[model samples]
Target: MEKKKVLLLGGAGFIGLNITKFLSENRDYTITVADNFSRGKKDEYLIKLLENPAISMIEGDFTVPATYDQLEKDYDYVYMLASVVGVNNTLEIPHEIIRINTALIYNTLEWLKASFVKKVLFTSTSECYAGTIDAFGYKVPTPETIPLTIEDIGHPRFTYAVTKMLGESGFLNYSRKCGFECTIVRYHNVFGPRMGFKHVIPHLAQRFLANETPFLVYGHDQTRSFCYITDAVEGTVLAMENERSNGEIFHIGTMDEITIEELIREAGNFFGYKGEYENAPTYPGSVARRCPDITKAKNMLQFEPKINWKDGLKLTLGWYKAFFESGKESFEKAFEKPKANV
Candidate 1:
C-alpha cells in the first residue's frame, strides 16, 4: 500500500503535535508539518519527531498567499489546524485572527482544487455555537445541526468564535463549489500537556503552583465539556480517514459537562493546594454553558473520550510539575507570572 501523504498546517502546536505523533507512529504515512513557529514546540519533541523517517517539517506562515504556492504539490490529505489561538490573544488581535484564519482556508482550498489532495480536515471550534441556548436557561448539548446565526463578535466579545465561524463557512462553501473533500471538527475545551496557560486548566495549575492568592474565576457558574487532548487527536484522525465525514461537521469533544467551580477545584486538588476562589467580573464574551452532542462523531468515526476529567487533570498537573522540576530555563520563562486575563 502506498503511504498516505499528509500536509498539516500548525503542526507544532499542542493538538497538531499530537496528531503528527500518532500518524507518524503508524509508519504508513509521510507527514509534513508546516508551522510559522508562532507556537512551535520545544526542541525535545521536535527532535524526536525528526528521527522518524516518515516525518518532515516546513517552516512557513499559512496566512500568506505565497504559502499555498509552496504547498501546491500533491498530498493525500491536508489538515488545516492553524489559527491565531488563545482567547485573550484573539480578543487583543481580532483583525489578525480573522485575516489569517480566513486566508489560510481560502489558500488551502484553492491549492487543493488545483492539486490532487484527497481530503481537507478543517478544525473548527465550539465557540461558534455561542448564544444558541434558550431563554429558559435550558442549554442543549449542541449538535452540528444547530444554526450559526450569532454574529455579535469583538474584543472580550466574540473574537475567536466569529473568526472560526467565518472559516467554517468558507471551507463549506469552497468544498461545495470546487468539489474538494472537507471535514470540520468543532472542538470544545481541549486540555493536555504542553497546552499553554491561556486555557482554564493550565492557567489555574500555574497559579496554584505559584501559590497565588484569591484565585480568580470568571463566570464560575458556566459549564463546559472539557475534552482530553488524546481523545481530540483520535477523533481528528478518525475524521480524516472516515469517508463519511466529507462535507460534514462533527463535534469532537467529551459529552460530559462540568462547571467552572468544579473544574477549578479539581485542578487545585490535583496540586494538593487549597486556594480561595473569587468570581471575577464577567468578560464581555464569556458563555454560560458549552457542551457538545457528539453522536455524529461516535456513529461515524467510532470516537469516544477515554480520559475522564479527574484522570486527565492528574496527568496534566503531573506534566507541569515535572516541567517545573526539570529546571529548563525556557519552560520557567514561559510559566513566569500567570496572565490572569486569558
Candidate 2:
C-alpha cells in the first residue's frame, strides 16, 4: 500500500513535533508541517526532521485559508494542532486565542470539505471540560457526553474552554454537513521533552535547575490529569486510525490526578532541588481541578497511558537538563517570566 499523506498544522510545537516524529518513524506517511512559529521556531527539530526524505516543512499561519490550500493536495489526514497556547498567554490574549482557534478550525474544515482529505483531527483541550471536574471529582472522569452548555463552563477560564468547545463543535458540524471524517482529542496536561517551558512541567524544571528562590505556586489546591507526550501522541494516532472515532471526542490523558503542591514537590524531587514554594496570587481563569474520564477512550480505542507520573517527571527532567545545558537562548527565554494570567 502507498503511504498516507498527513498535513500537520502547528507542527513545530511540542505535541505536534512529537506527533510528527512518531509518525515519521513509521516510514508510512508523507508528513508536511506548517507552523507560524508564533511561540518560537523549532529550527533544530525541523532540521532533523528534514533529514527524513518523507518530511516537508512549511512556514505559514493557520488562520490563513490560502496557507491550508497550499498544502491541501492529496492528503489522507489533516491534523490541526495550531492555537495560542499556555494558560497565562491565553488569558492575557483571550481575543487572539478566540479568533485564531476559531478561524483555524473554520478554515481547516472548509478546506478539507472542499478537498479530498480522508480524515481530519482537531486537537481540543481538557480546558473545555473545566468546571466539570469540580462537580464530578477525580473519582468520576468527565465524559464526552456531558453537555458543553454555558452552565457547564461558568468560569472566566472558560475563555479557552469556550473557544475550544466552539472549535470541536465547528469541526463536527462541518464534518457531518460536508462528508469528511473528523476526530477530536481533548488533551490534558501533556508534558514531555520539547514541551514549551512556559507550561508547568518545564517551568518547574527550569526553576528547580536554576535553584530559583520562592518557587511560585498558583492555586495550590488545584489539580490536573497529566499525560506524557508519548501517551498523548499514541492516543491521538489511534483515534485517527479508528473509524469509530469520527465525529467523536476522546479525552487523551492519564486518569490519575495530581495537585499543584504535589506536582511542585515531585518536580523538585526529580530535579534534586530543595527550593521552598511560596503561594502566589492565583491567575485569572484558573481551574480548581481538571481530570478526564478515559472509559470512552479505553472502550472505543483501547487507549491506556503507559507512563505514570513519577516516570514521566523523570523523563521530562532529563530533557530539561539537556535543554538547559545546550545553552539555547530561546530555550532559556522559555523560562524567563510567567504570564500574569496563566
Candidate 3:
C-alpha cells in the first residue's frame, strides 16, 4: 500500500505543525508543509519534526497565486489551515486580512480545479457565529448549523470572520461544482505549546513570569471553550478520513467553557504567584460568551477531547514559562498595539 500524501497549507504554524507531527509520527503520511514562516523562522520544534524522512517544507507567501504552482498535483488530503488570524492583525491590518485570506481561498480553489486532490478540509473558526450567539441569544453550546452573523461588519475585528465565512461558502460550493470532497471545521479557542505569542494563554504566562502586580483580567466575565492542539488535530484528521463527513461542517472544540478571570488566576497559580488581579476591558467587537456544541462530531467522528482546560493550561503555561525564561521574545513582541494606520 502506498503512503498517503498530505499537504498542510500553512503547515509551519502552531496547529499545522502539530497536525504534521501527529500524522508523520504515528501514520504513513508523506507530509508537505508550505508556509511563509511569517511568525518567525522554523523553530526547533518544527526543525526536529521535519527531520523525519517522510516530511518536507516549502517556504513561500501562499497568498500569491503563483505559489500554488509549486505544489504537486496529487494529494490524498489537503488541510487548508492558512489564514491571517489574531485580533491584533485584524485590528491593525483589516484590509490586509481581507486581501490575503480571500486571495488564498481563491488561489487554492483554482489550484484544486487543476489538481487531483481527493479531499480538502478548510479550517474555520468560531468567530463566524459570535454575533449570532451574543446579540441574538443563541443557545450557549452553539452548533455548526447556527446561522453565522457579524455584529458589526464595519469593525476591524470582524474582518477575520468575514473572510472565514467566505471560505466556508467558497470551499463547499466549489467542491460541489468542481467534483471533490470538502469538510469544514470551525475551531473554538484551540491552544497548546508553541501556539505563538499573540494568544491569551501565552500572554498570561509572560505576564505572570514578569510578576506584574494587580494583573488585569480582560473581559473577566466572557467565556470560551478551548480545545487543546493535539485533540484538535485528531478531530481534523477524523473529519477528513471519515467518508460520512463529506460536504459537512463540524465544530472541532471541547465543551469546557471557562472564564477569562478563571483562566488568568489559574495561570497565576501555575506560576506560583499570589498576585492581585483587576478586571480590564477586552478588545472591541469581542463576543461576551462563546462555546461550541460538538454533538455532530461526537456522533459522527466519535471525537472526544481528552485533555481538560486546566491540564492543558498547565502544559501550555509551562511551555510559555520556559520559553520566556529562554530569552525568546518574538511571539510576545509581535503582539503590539494596533496602529491607526497599517
Q: Which structure among the candidates has the greatest lDDT?
A: 3
The lowest-lDDT stretch of 10 consecutive residues in candidate 3 is 333-342
| Candidate 1 residue pairs in clash (backbone atoms < 3 Å) | 154-158
Off by over 4 Å in 3: 335-342
Q: Over the stretch 1-342, how does candidate 2's per-residue lDDT look in tens digits?
A: 898899888888888888899999864888999989886476777789889989998998879887875685668888888887767655467677778878877787778778888888999886665555544543346777765544334444456777788888888888888878899998888888877767777777667777877777766777777898899999999999899998899988988987777887887777776667887765555667677889999999999899998898889888888877788664434655642222
The residue pairs found clashing in candidate 3 are none
Q: What tens digits encode model 3's per-residue C-alpha lDDT throughout 151-201?
A: 888989889999999999999999998878999999999999988877788
Candidate 1, residues 208-325: lDDT per residue as tens digits?
A: 8788778777667777888889999999999988899999999999888888778877887787767587887554556677888999899989998999978988898888777666
Instruction: Tell me how candidate 2 scores on lDDT.
Output: 0.78
Q: Output the better candidate (1/3) by TM-score.
A: 3
Query: Which ranges of candidate 1 are over 4 A from the true structure?
Result: 134-138, 151-156, 329-342
TM-score: which candidate is best?
A: 3
Candidate 3 structure, TM-score to reference = 0.96
Error of 3 at 52 (Å): 0.9
lDDT of each: 0.78, 0.78, 0.87
